[model samples]
Target: MRQKVFNWGRYPQGDVDLLPLYYLEELDELTSKPCIARGNGRCYGDSSLSSQVISTITFDKALIFDKKQGIFKCQSGMQLSDILDIIVPHGWFLPVTPGTKFITVGGAVASDIHGKNHHTEGSFSKHIIEFEIYSGEGLHYTCSAKEHPDLFHATCGGMGLTGIITSVTFQLKKIESVFITRVQEKARNLDEAFELFEKYSNHTYSMAWIDCLKGGNSFGRSIMMAGEHTTLNELNAKQKPEALKLLQGSKLNIPLDLPSFMLSGLSVKSFNELYYHKILGKVKQDKTYFDQFFYPLDAINNWNRMYGKHGFIQYQFVLPLSTSRAGLVEIMEKIRNQGSGSFLAVLKQFGPQDGMLSFPMEGYTLALDFPFRPGLLKFLNKLDELVLKYHGRLYLTKDARMDAEVFKASYPNLGEFINVLDKYVPKRSFSSFQSERLFG
Candidate 1:
């Protein structure tokens, strides 16, 4: 089928020939075409976009499950949300998950997504035991940390450049309950927020929502939150049932695309103030369901539409711990000075850069959602310089408009990644808009 496809960000829209791959034999047939695997289309940018896109949604199926060992082998298209629905009730959880559960298992591995818990648990690639990939040569190979380690590392965070992931076998963390004990801390400014994060580094998960509009003494003021999975014993007997209940999919949705002006500076400022006060008023929240703690935005379906038809860009970057504070403060100040409003400005600490092209490092990562507008690219380019100055790199999964030069500078392991690609990928057999843009 031929159709238009835009990423979750809704920017850089384009038409593509969507090829559906159902059986394994189809992989051989696809070898003659220029293509890239497409999962749930949750990626924020063009990483999954291609003129000849391979739709993997139909390939979703759980092939194997070992409840005792907390191991699962499933087809690539199975979504994290679906997996969570099945595993949470069984006391097993994904080792790492991004903010939303809408992404597929293959997408998670391809992007090597990290979560609020990355400071301790690392990214999704850490838990993957092995996976099967259909490479550009039209051959299937099993890649793991031990077996075909080169291809394994490359494929984990390779962003579908190496090949189409067929199936994945990964380890799942065991959980006693579906509840999480959350703690909220109100930071007067960015400095305090960083201090609080360091003080609470031992927590299982941590994140902050900063008010980027503020300046001087109030610059980077935020509400920091931390969470730990609550054991069954930690929950009151009466609350156990509610906490253990499996989460349902979101039915609440934005019926229409909001006008771009709806997110104007004044409006966003008002909302930020209210949110800051709301979180500040609550010092702690206990016995929250796992879904509530990790995927709050998922409650509102099609939330991206709020950014309007032109769409938005989610710019997420990480800096080394040594330069993170200064780098972030400078970037936040720049945004404030530019008079741009990013209603969603998130901050989290990452442990270390593990995967070959992983976005994280031992530092602080900040994410800002900016609605697309005139001069937006210029503005992002400026931010790119700031990130590069501090030796930071943007997250490829969320990027929409980063220049190839900026990308090359950000990810130093690009050579290694490309070397692996060269060895496995045949000419014009596997490609994406992003790969072509960044390394074409």
Candidate 2:
């Protein structure tokens, strides 16, 4: 059936033919066409989009669980939320999870997602044991670190270009409680934020929310949050029962598209100022549920609608530690001058790079959300220039308007990634609109 499909950002929508796969046998028929596999539509951009899109949601299933060993083998289409619901109560948790649990295992593998604990745990692909994948050429392979290792590495972060993942096997981390002993510290400026990150690097998890609207001495004012998993013994009797729960609260939904003016510079500045002080008023240390700490925004259903009908762009980039401060300040200054306010700006530190095309590196990463406007595209193009100048790169999972030249410049390994794709999937049958735009 023909339908409109878009990534999580809700920008650059496309009309495509949605092919639903209920059985593995159906892949043989889809091999004749150019297509890409899509799962839960959680990727922020066009990486999962194609004229002929294959929907994998029907393949969702939990195939096996090794309770004692903490290993989970499941179909690629299974959502992270489903896995958490089944394993959290069993004292097991995801080794690494992105900000949201609404994504699919295949999507996570394709993006090679990183989390707050990336300084120590690495990306999602680190925990993967093996996975079954198929090229559009009717070839199926079981890939792992020790078996078909080349295909395994390429497929993990190849963004659905290598092939369509069928099933995955990975290990899970054991947790004593679902609550996190989260600590918050308000950084006076960008420098202090960096210091706090280093000061708390010993923690299991760390992330910062920065105020992008402010400049001068107040530039990069943020609240750094560091968290560690709580132990069962630490929780009192009243908190014990709730510690095992996953999502314990209600959700609010944006029923319709909001007016574009709702997110203007004035409104955003006001919100950021209030939010910064709100966190300042909170206790330095407190206990919170895992869901609340990790996926607070998920509680708002269809939250993208708040950006209005024109949608928004989620710009995320990483710069080496040596140049992060200067590069980040320049970009923030450009945004402030443009009168574009990113209320949801997030800053975090990333460890060494792992996957062949993994987004993270040994440096700092910042993510921002900007509602679309008449001159927004041009403004982002300028930001790309700054990113390239600082030896930084953009995240494909959150990009929509980046061109081929910028993509090549940012990802230095583009040639290697392309060679691997051509060597295995010669026909390049597994392709997405993004694949054509950036690598075709």
Candidate 3:
């Protein structure tokens, strides 16, 4: 009814009116036109959306779900949390999920999003079977690795540039319960973390949190956490209910953004310290709802507001195994030397690269949140050079910086991806700051 444009980080952006279209004759014809697909609007960056008016929400619904084969066929606009609400009760969970469940299934596939078990499952493409997409030609087509391999490869992490994904069918994972039996292993230093991860990686899931401010023995201080869904026996009668479902009956928005100064190292460090210590120890049988287990941060309404008004950018990248340790040391040293305060820092071990443009690789990947500083662009430029020097690359989904030439040099498959997109070249679509910078 009204135009309301929202950015994931409350970053610089203007309002866009999202027109509504359904699946009937009027809607079908509308959807068949040239347009960009928008999901829960959780790109963190702008690749998955455009400024052009598109009818995305009107077609939202789970088109199909065959529990028999653990296959889910749903509208592209369906949010992951919406799926979890119905899936968990049936002993099903998303095989790979990003940090927040607010993202949509289409967004996950378009970005080829990876998760904690990236070392095991890869990304959304690995689980995705097929998709129905409407292209710039105003026609829907089918694509998959086995069918239209070229389109499928390009569409995965294509940033919605190739076409508008209308529906996707993907494999679902079977789990015993919605609860995760977590183990919180506190590491005094980065070496302890490397040791712990290498030792416990045989477990189901692995992820760690690092204190970007510390160094020496405390340099890269962190806590390594691993977990798996609890079995029926692991859960008591009270813990495993027949119909304990995730609730999403409500949603809230930040009315206005706050000042950039709202987030500082001191405040962020305090939050990180409290978060780290609270979950320390074995935590052998800690229990939680699916939401709490998968997306704990989502509990806070307008959580992005904590970053302040100027809006922050997430610098995430992966360093190959050979240079991971050395590269990480240098990056951390530089950050410390420059007095750059990180609001949030996450470290994850990547197993291997999957999709054509997927970001993870066989090494260590780290994500850090920083407020926009005067020379932030230059700082990232320096970091980019180092990443390339170490045979590393940055994540496109979370990036608000990086040039196209740098991206092409890092990802040799850029040309191939572009060629595939040529089949359905969009003429009048909107891209984010990162998209423009990397592929204008």
| lDDT leader | 2
Better of 2 and 3 by TM-score: 2
**Residue range 1-440, candidate 2, lDDT tens digits:** 88899988898898989888788898989767889999999888889899999888888999998989999999889999999999998889999999999999999999999999999888988999999999766789999989988888888888998888999999999999998999999998999999999989999999999999898898999999999999988999998887777666899999999998899888999999888998656339998889998998899998888999888999999999899999999999998888786775999999997667789989999999989889988999999999999999999889888888998888877777778787889888888878788874
Tell me the TM-score of each prediction against the true structure. 0.97, 0.98, 0.91
Full-model lDDT for every candidate: 0.88, 0.89, 0.74
Residue pair clashes in candidate 3: 215-219, 258-309
Candidate 1 regions exceeding 4 Å error are 241-243, 280-282, 426-428
Can you write out model 1's per-residue Cα lDDT over 146-241, one digit (the tens) per residue?
998989999887889888999999999988888888899899899899998998899989999989998878888888989989987787779677
Residue 92 in model 3: lDDT: 84
Better of 1 and 3 by TM-score: 1
Q: After superposition, how far is residue 332 of candidate 2 from its true place, in Å?
A: 0.8
**Tens-place lDDT digits, model 3, residues 1-440:** 33656557545454554666456334345444334566776666555434454545566699787877788888877888778877777778888999898887778887889888888778778888899876654567798888888888888887777766778899999988767777778888888889888977887777888888876668987888788877788877776674344555354555566676556656766876786677646444465556665676777667777667666677889999999999999987887666565755889998877667878789999988777668877988988888998889988877656788779888878878777666555453334445666777
Clashes of each: 0, 0, 2
Off by over 4 Å in 3: 1-6, 15-17, 24-35, 53-55, 240-259, 279-285, 426-433
**lDDT at residue 356 of model 1 (Cα atoms):** 78
